[model samples]
Target: MNDKVLIVGAGAIGGFYGGLLAKAGADVSVVCRSDYDVAKHYGYRIDSYALGNWQLMPNQVLRHVSEYQGQPDYLILCTKVTADIDRVTLIRDAVAPCTTIVLIQNGVEIERELQQAFPDNLLVSGLAFICCNRNAPGEISHLAYGKLILGNLSGRQEPKTQYLRDLFLGAGIECVISEDIVASRWQKCVWNAPFNPLSVLSGGLATQAILQNQENFVRRVMREVCSIADACGHPLPADIVENHIALTRDMPPYKTSMLLDFERGHTMETEAILGNAVRAAQRQSVDCPCLESLYVLMQLLELQIRSSSLLN
Candidate 1:
């Protein structure tokens, strides 16, 4: 396997995968912010809970984009979807012409934005069904599953894409080179659209919230999102929802990433995660009351949190 991997944003997903790749002897370089210095001084320490692993090392942890050396064969973006586009543009110079840009973000629109920005480069979409958090600098904690789903959203499944898929498979990461990538994305959203913000707003695990407070509301949101998916010609059947509900039931007690951000007083991934489904519902003339209500609730909660933080 090719060892040169450039991992942008050394957070939960980035640190987990990057640490794994490094431990497996891949030449991994994590592109971080000012924390790179401290990480370098100590090490990229990853204390994971789910994978039953921990890693501490110092390979290539660069602070500035200019300090990034060697053209990368793979540029893996593991940031939140709402992160600014300029971050990608900043690292464009470090990528070789043939570098494969893999976006390991939560939402659906990041690939769209990246395609718009880097029209010539190869862009791949990834969806991870895992629970992870960066509780400390240079440290990542995995809480639950670590399966990954990847696809070529542009519909061009090239040899390089196949190679990347094979690489992940060899790394023991479960992945699917989905043919119906759009359907897969939206279907994945069926789970995320409700769970992410609901977890944040209600302070509950997805299954707990679904079973405890509003089981019908959970079903309603899924039904509405599935309707939108069907209207968009990607019908997620009832069996799929049944299977996904089962999967969520198996997950450990973990809050969504948006809730983590909310707890930290940081801006949640509003536009990409929840907002995309809401906008898509509007565009397709599909009324999604649950999604709309959660969106508004989250906006209010964030406003209150920020206002209170500023006052403090």
Candidate 2:
């Protein structure tokens, strides 16, 4: 039987991955809100780097997770982890006892919420290291890199985890199963903690621009993240900081997801990406002055946006 994969929130990351899974012969379905009409009629138009540009119709398209039919082998939660929505509540209805829930999102200290909600369900933590965007409804633009790293949040390598890995590999996607996925989460944070917020705080500048102007600032934040990770027993590579700077330098001029969110007048992921890291630091008695400042700025900006919307 083909793997029945149900994607919640078919945005850039969701569309790109779910579309590829369909192309790889998995039974992929998506629950889309705003792009329902566009995707259902025209299918997903994906411009990918590794799989080439292609369009394919998922097995089904429903507006909400409650409408999902049958027991999905995997439920990939692709929604943005923001203050407005409860991530656990969004996909709780669609989950079954044996189902595996994969969190393809960015943030630290997120797995606890899912594990607590569905203690029996297999929990997979995923991090996407790609520069992609949803240009329009039913559209995705994959600029550079399309790699995914996954690890079981429960610390067990079940057969399902291996199956998911093999599935992505079959799709020509580079997928890695980490020995310590929590450490991988922290490693990704090193890159995210700096560039994501910097992009938003720098008046919507792209990653390249921020690196050019404030390389030291970026490194400092990354260093603090690594230190905190070490304290948390997820020590990263010593050269990881420089590696990110080099990667950003070579990548095409691109706006980060957080920056894009701010640009679209949506709530940015301040708490998940920045706030959580700072909190972890506080718990460890480690100082993260730079991340704290960015968290404060992003929080203030979000309040300003909410206030502006209320007045208008």
Best by lDDT: 2
* Candidate 2 residue-wise lDDT, 110-145, digit = tens: 889889999888999998988788889999998878
For model 1, where is the 10-residue window of minimal lDDT? 203-212
lDDT values for all models: 0.73, 0.89
Among the numbered candidates, top TM-score falls to 2
Could you tell me every candidate's TM-score relative to the true structure? Answer: 0.88, 0.96
Error of 2 at 225 (Å): 0.7
Model 1: per-residue Cα lDDT over 189-306, one tens digit each: 8787777788877754545655466656777787877888887777776686777677777766557677777777667887786788788788889888888998889779877886
Query: After TM-score superposition, what is the CA distance of residue 6 in candidate 1 from its true location, in Å?
Result: 0.8
User: Stretches of candidate 2 above 4 Å error?
Assistant: none
